[model samples]
Target chain A: MHFNMKLGLTLFAIYLLFYCGFVFINTFSPQTMEQTPIEGVNVAILYGFALIVSAFALALIYGVFCRPEEEVNSTSDPVATTKGDV
Target chain B: MIYDVSPTAIVVFLLFVGFTLGLSFWLGRKAKSSEGYFAAHGQIPWFVNGVAFAGDYLSAASFLGICGMIAFYGYDGFLYSVGFLAGWIVALFVVAEPMKKLGKYTFADALDAKFNSKGIKLAAGISTLAVSIFYLIPQMVGAGVLIQPLLGFPHWVGVLMVGAVVITIVVTAGMVSTTYVQFLKGGLLVVFSAILTILILNRGLETKSNFKELGPVAWDALETAFADKEIEILPNDGIWKDKLDSDQRDYVVSRNPNDPPGKITVWKQVKDANNLVRLLECQLLETRAGKRYINGLPEGTGEGQAQLEPVGSLSKLPDDKTETGPLGAFGFIKTIQNSEVKLWRDDKKFPSLKNGDKATVYYPKLVPGSQVLRPGEHPKFAGIRRDGIFDKLNFLSLMLALFCGTASLPHILIRYYTVKDAASARKSTIVGIASIGFFYVLTLFLGLGAMTSGAMDVSSSNMAAPLLAKSISPLLFAIISAIAFTTVLGTVSGLILASSGAVTHDLAVSFLGLELDDQAQVRLAKIASVVVGVIAIALGILFKGLNVGYLVGWAFSVAASANLPALVMLLFWKKTTKQGIIAAVIVGMVSSLAWILLSQDTFKSVYGIADAQGVVPFSQPGIVTIPLGFLTLVVVSLMTGKSKS
Candidate 1:
């Protein structure tokens, strides 16, 4: 497996988990988001901004880490991984 | 609602449009070949392509729809920003490099690269066209909404103007010009939005609303007007307009014979729990008439005439401060958390005392700052506060669509082919994420600024950011409006390009098995762009006055359902067959689109069928349709016995 693909999937999973936390909190414990965790900003506002910033932060990490590998494996030969049937 | 068309705005808008057209014409020579026309010869700079992604993604919905929503509804609009930015994460990590490596032109190219099947091409091509057109409707509608205030043109005029200009852009230079235009607009949009946010912080929150300019009568004056029969009190037909009973109603309504028939303009006299009087303006426009009218007179701010004044404001400041002068970023939000905001509420249940007129009263509702900063303010996100499973699912479904939709958008996907190499694609996507993320963060401030600026149009949330700019300065409004118009142009052009590519490259060359050379294909693509542009314009004109944000959400749902499952499974799972991809695209597109059409939102807003529940469980179909898409693909692939990989 290409390091880029492995790294990309790992980062994706992490971000997805973070994003799900946001949706879950907003849905279930909306009162929890109203708490002013920071000096003036509430958790809703704080977490929303954090999500936006984290996307960039994660993208920056990916750009810094992904080295040039064989491009053909990533695009032309996408079926490199033979996973189980869905 | 009749904004005095500023001469400065007209000149500035003309200059921006002129510059864009000139750029397209000069770049026309470079796009003679199909490769150059469709993909810019894969020569777009990584940074430029990245900024173009911001321009393309922001659309009218992002800049205008989101800011206006945040301004009016509070933090719920910012929820869109978070969801939208998160989608780019999917684009960057999973889709960007692979899309760049596989496709030559359209999104269909990438899907068909693995399996050169005509059925896949046909299904994917149809999906691209459907998704692109669905996205186009809102952009075109937003364009018209913008033109009304800037050019003093009617909505149809605005739609036609955008269509003509965008058709010119796409036909002349295709992707090359679209890329450069997006890059320019993206840079300008981000920079100007930052400036606008700074101005908002500098001109801090105030306790008093600034709605006096529209000349709302005092409570005593309303009583006098009612006594003199200048206006009549509407008897409550059992529905209270903003907590006021029919006997307790303070505002009066009157319509003269000289006023445009079937049009109603409302001025609200709202008294809070403390009996503090607040004035608000609202309008229910009937635009089928030949001439525009506001408050029973011709639309203008002249003698015996009135306009819908700006509405949103802070009714109370924290710690008895009438105004918090020049707050810091965090300080601004904190201050709002402690203050009371005067949000306008619209109720359409009232039938005008006069015969055959539909009246919508927009009254000011004072809400705590903490509530405004939470998620349940807008009806779209109001589901979160409910215990109903379907209600909760609605919010979750919307967020899911927004999270998964970005990587699936056809217009966004076609952009990957414009840059050379998979590495450049990856780098440009990072740049896109940075630019889009920063802009979305600014949307929070822009929306809050507009919310507190007393410069919001209650009738249309799409006008919030531009009206906020107008409040700061007319010069700023002029520049911002021009930039916003260009924002629409950039996104529409990209969508049109995708549609055209689908027609010529996928539908004609691949699916229909046509014999077309490079030059012929480019010509056909240009012709196709014109047809799509015209269709978009017609739809824009047809769907006027609908909320641009909701339409955009529906587009996201459709895109996420149709495109994401096929794209993801093809790349990750080996058992994925051509039939599976075909079934996924067809089922996902049809089911999601059908779901949206039959949803309660459509029943109420689009079909005008009141008092009927939608057949679907929720308005947004992503939660059901996205999983359904994946399940269909897997089941089909297994049944087809796919092992070609």
Candidate 2:
């Protein structure tokens, strides 16, 4: 497996957990979301901003860590392997 | 509110249109071949393509609709921003790089790359067209909505203008010009939005809803004026009209039982003993005779005519502070959380009218800052706040759709082909996520600012961002609006380009086995672009006044259901067959579309059939239809003897 695809999957999973936490809080523990731990900003606003910022952060991590285009293309599967079995 | 047409807006708007057209014409020479027309010959700079991604993705719905929603209903609109930006994770980590490696032009190309089957081409091509057309409607409607105030033109005129301009953009240079236009618009939108956010934070919070330059007058002074005998609460009678003088003290004008038919009761502004002011609500009425009236006067700001006054303001601040000095980002949010905002409630149906006259009233509703900051306040998501399982499911389905939908959208997917390779595509997507995410974060402030701007047009939530700009300065409003119009133009051109590619490349050439040359393919695509552009214009004009965000939500659902399952399975599942992809695409597309059409929302809004129950349990189909798509593909693949590749 290519290192880039593996790293991409890992970052994607981490972000998915963060995103799910957001949805779960909004859905179930909505009262917790209303709590303003950060002065005027509630958990909901803070969480929303965190999710957005984290997406870019994850993408930057992937961009920085992934192999260059030439190296990946040379060793990458012809079909460009993803998570599921082929 | 009266959207007074400004010469500044006109000049700025015309300059934007002219510059867009000029850019398209100048770049027209480069895209003479099919590769250039379809994918900019995979030569767009990664950075440019990334910003263009923002330009293409942040449609009128994201800018106008979401901000309007937030302004009116609070944090629910920002929830949409979170959902929308979250979709980029799927686009970047899963779809972008692989999509660059496999596809040549449209989304269909990637899906059909492994299987040279006509079924794949036909099914994927149809899905592309369906999603593109559905997405195009909101952009078109948003175009008209923006134009009405910016250029003083009617709705249809705005739709026509956007259609014509976008058609020229697509037909002239295709993806090359579209890419640059998107990049320019994307960059301006982000920069200006940041500047707007800064201005909002600097203006800080004020208790009084400042309309025009009217500062809060002392209650003691107002009490002295109201102490006159001219102050009287009159029952519905002709006597109320005689006392309706500006010099007189505040009085209540009750509805007259003997009032003429077709005349709706008006809400009059009156002062209470406490001197707490309740603003007069504006009503817009359209009579059967095609005449329009605003607040019982002809719809104009001329003598004897009435226009809606700008609304929305903070009724109370923390510590009863009349105003807070310039705030930081956290300070702004904190201030709003502790203050009370006066948002408007739109009442469309009034029973007083006897004739066939339609009336929409905009009245104020004061809500606590905490409730406004919380989710589930918007009517669309109000279900989630309730114990109803179906409503919760509806919200969940929409969130899921937004997460998956970005990767599947034909227009967005086609952008990968504009970049050179997997690495560039990855980088471009990263750039896209950064800009789009930053813009979305700014949306919260934009919405909250507009919520407290006290210059809102209660009639249309779509005008929040532009109207917020207007509250700042006319020049800023003009520039922001011009940028917004270009936002619509960039998105519509991308959709049109995607549609044309599907038609000429997939449906015409691949599905029908037409051996067309590169030049011929480009020509056919141009012709297809014109045809799709025309259809989009008509749909845009037709769907005017529908909430731009709702239509976009439906588009996302359809895209996620139809394309995502098929694309994902084909990418990862070696057992996936061409027949499986074909079946999945068709079923997913049809089912989602059917679910939307039959949903209770459609029953009320689209069909106008009150009291009619939808067949589906919920409005959004993503939760059901997306999994259904995957299941259908897997089952069909097993039955059809898989591993075609």
Candidate 3:
């Protein structure tokens, strides 16, 4: 497997672990979810927001690591490189 | 029910429509060929296509439906947002690069790429059409919901207007125009939603104390009236009495003083054979110039009519102050976490008629902020609290469907073709995820904001966001609503375009081998768009009052079951065959669709049949049908593996 693909999948798996854990916990342990992990912040709301933020972070990470080596060498602008590919 | 045609809203709406149409016409000149019409000749920028992806994906369901759901049901509505955004991970990791590397116009192109089989084309084409049409229903319904309040048009008129406008968009420029329109609306939606969220945070949480006091006063009067039959109640107390059937069986009424004068509240005294009143069923009655309006409309009286005043207040502040004014994002959520919110609960009962009007009442239940911020508030999500076996399974199934559905949705998949290559597809998917993810986070605030904005229309939960916007200012309402209407337009256009591509490219050319020329194919696709638009309009009007997000859940389940299994197998498994793909698509689509139609939710909600008559045990079919799809594909593939090249 490509290093980029492996890294992307790794991040993806970790993200899913947190995401699915939050969901399962919410389903099975509603009392735990109702608890405020931080001051005035319920676990459910905190976990939900975390899941969304992690998705963006992972996407950015994947974009950086997964960019084709040839394109990286040829152009600095990712958009320009993609536009030029056609 | 009290919608007056807003001239400002009408002007803004007209301008948006006119601008979209004008852009479509200009873009149409460039889309003379099949490739340009269907895929924009793969020339669209990755950034633009990415935002357009958000535009396409964030349909009326995400904006209007999620906001409304959260507004009414609290944290459970944001679960839809969570499920929705989680699906992007599947799209980005599993589907994006491969999809761009394979297919050209429709999703069927990718599935049929390896084998070039007619059965694959036929099965996949049908699935695409089915999913697209199912998805279109909600967008159309949302359009009607928006039009009723904004332009004061009836529901069907809004549906027709959207159908005509979207059909024009698809026919004029296809993917190119659809892409730009989605980009425009997608950007506008996020920005305006952020502005709205800021306004909500700045305004902070305020108490609507009138309803809180009214509840106690009404309860006291009812006790007194039941005790003394001849007691004269003061009009200022907003309590009245009516005796039924000359038996002098008195029932007390409590009117919403917040409502306009002449609205009626009916209290029915249910008496047993012993002539003793056993139960009091409160029903809201509204007679506007002689036309009886029950539960915000003349047609449906059984629907709940008790409009509780917006009743969320800051119970405890983070700094031990009364209100944490103008809190940051984290602070905003924290403030809500420490507060008490009055969420209304709809009491479900068989519709009862009173004095020639249908009446029902929803009682407001006060919930602590901790409870409101937690999962399992909505009835659909009650299992999260109870942790029952079937409830757990249903939650798992819904989550699985949502996670898998984004990659399989025909409209979302077709956007891959609008970009240049696999790398562009990857970048665009990333961009789309970022934009969509940010918007979804804002949805949590937007929904919670609307929940306490004191401007909710209890009759339609879908109107929460627009009404919340209106609460801020009329101009903001017009802009947000106009953008929301375009949100419908952008999504419906993409869906119609995908459906048309399936008809022209996959079904006609691949399955039937018609051998049509390029221009003829584009023309044929245009014709298909019009037909699909009309079907969508009809379905939209038919499912008029159903929640858009709930309707979208069905679409996701169907897509995940039908398309995801075959696509995943073909991409990952070595022994997958054309016959296997065909069987999987057919079985998955039919079974899920059939399951939804037969489920208990459908029986009680859609068909109005008794729950006991419902055929299916569960409402969601993802757990069963998705696995069934994979199993069918594997078995069929092993049987037909010898024939594989």
List residue ranges in candidate 2 displaced over 4 A.
A69-86, B210-231, B236-288, B353-356, B642-645
**What TM-score does candidate 3 reach?**
0.88
Candidate 1 deviant stretches above 4 angstroms = A72-86, B210-299, B642-645
Candidate 3 residue lDDT tens string, B243-306? 2323343343434545544344444434445544433323343544566555343533233433
TM-scores, all candidates, are: 0.91, 0.91, 0.88
Cα lDDT, all candidates? 0.86, 0.85, 0.80
lDDT of 2 by residue, A1-86 (tens): 56777888889899999999988778766788888887768998999999999999999999999888554544333322331111
| Per-residue lDDT of candidate 1, residues B167-265 (tens digit) | 999999999999999999999999999999999999988976654312234555553443343334333343334545443554544343444563333
lDDT of 3: 0.80
Give every collision pair in model 1: B1-B308
Q: Evaluated on chain B only, what is the TM-score of candidate 3?
A: 0.88
- Poorest stretch of ten by lDDT in candidate 1 chain B: B230-239
Between candidates 1 and 3, name the one with more favorable lDDT: 1
True contacts kept of 2: 0.51
Model 2 agreement with the true structure over B1-645: per-residue lDDT tens digits: 548889999998899889989998998877787888888887899999999999999999999989999999999999999999999999988888778877878888789878888889999999999999999999999999999988889999999999999999999999999999999999999999999999999999898753312112343343333324232223433533444444243333333334433233344354546655443434445443576676465666656565667888998899999999899999899888988887788666532232556756566666889999998898888887788889888988999999999999999999998876788888899999999999999999999999888788877889999999999999999999999999999999999999999999999999899999978998999999999999999999898868888799999999999999999898778899999999999999999999999999999888888788898999999999999999999999999874565
Which candidate tops DockQ?
3
Reference-based lDDT, residue B539, model 3: 95
Q: What is the lDDT, from 0 to 100, of the residue B583 in candidate 1?
A: 97
iRMS per model in Å: 8.5, 7.5, 5.4
